[model samples]
Target: MTSFAQSERAGLCDTFLEVGPDAPTLCSDWRARDLAAHLILRERRPDAAIGMFLAPLAGRTDRIQASLAQRPFEELVDTIRSGPPKWSPMALGSIDEAANFAEFFVHHEDVLRGVDPSARRQLDAAEQKAIFAALPRIGMLSLRSCRVGVVADAGSYGRRSLRSPKDDHGNVVLTGEPGEILLHIFGRTAVTDVELDGADHDVESFRKTDLGT
Candidate 1:
């Protein structure tokens, strides 16, 4: 079966084709071409990609990504469409599903919602299940700094209490579809559709916390 990761990759490429290289994306200061280049760089250049996690090497990663951005926009999108090169561990069957699903999904929305703020989509049962399955891990990463306890209320997918590294007495219940929840966790909170339920102070504190990117 074609995974949501693959589907999101294709959809992102299609959007890239539609919007062209100069199009805006939610990623700070990145155009469609730049975002495509980042994806390519991420999957194809491990040496440079290390900079993404390591602050000291970030300059090299930025320079390499900028160089890649100068390539033809169509070529960049095509490279992404073709999937990671064989040399990339992301090409492994399991890693592809585990890693790329949210990566592509969020970047895909970066394109779509960047063009139009109201352009969110609904996920099917399987798709929701896919995103829901990932919520716990992402929740932990995203909510670690939250002062109040965090609980994801993903409607039919049920709820998950996140691991907040520092917690006060209050709890914040984040209510939304899995995709919207994921988007919020990914630092797209301004555009995300999730609702927060908690004390005024707790909700405000949760809002003040930085989420994923």
Candidate 2:
């Protein structure tokens, strides 16, 4: 896992450096540099760190990005590669290592969408596991409206399973590679690409509720 994390981190750093200053990202308002800064911040300050506990009031994303921008690009990448600071307020303890892998995998995809789409192909099983482990916590399924089943392509990173309230009432079989399923559930853009063996409404509603605005 450490080796995989290092590889993913290196890929991410390379992508960040490769993206032009004017490049846009899937994150909408954030530019490529902002995305790079975000990753650096996560490496340095995890949720369990002191800053998170103290300013508990301050928005973590904002704090991290602000800190990242304070340094030059070379310094920022150097800091991330050096690992989290010992005195950071948001360290995740023993799990900090896991968080490192998780952030790299997810953010790598985010920045890659703008810089290099092929970069995602480089993710290995370990990196996928780390990102998958973090998904449920991201609120992909809103129990208030639906039940989701996620299955990944034995080889993809964005797999997920989701059923709408209506689909739960009838017989249906919705299946796809994990990455496609997850992207659809997150209301990203995979729904059109996934195959539905039953009523399409279930997938439609799920997308509408989560991915669709």
For residues 81-157, write the lDDT of model 2, one tens digit per residue. Answer: 66556676335444555445544655566666645443346435565565555545443332334443333332345
Off by over 4 Å in 1: 164-167
What is the alpha-carbon lDDT of model 1 when measured against the actual structure? Answer: 0.87
Model 1: weakest 10-residue lDDT segment is 161-170
Q: Give lDDT per model, in order.
A: 0.87, 0.52
Error of 2 at 22 (Å): 3.9
TM-score per model over all chains: 0.95, 0.62
**Pairing residues by index, what is the TM-score of model 1?**
0.95
Q: Which stretches of candidate 2 lie over 4 Å from their true place?
A: 45-67, 87-94, 116-187, 190-198, 211-213
Supply candidate 2's per-residue lDDT for 116: 46
Best by the TM-score measure: 1
Pairs clashing within candidate 1: 186-212
Encode model 1's per-residue lDDT on 1-213: one tens digit a residue.
Answer: 768889999999999999989999999899998899999988988889899999999999999999999998888988999997888778887889888999999999999999998997867889988898898877767776777888889988988887552545588888999899899888898898899998998888888888884
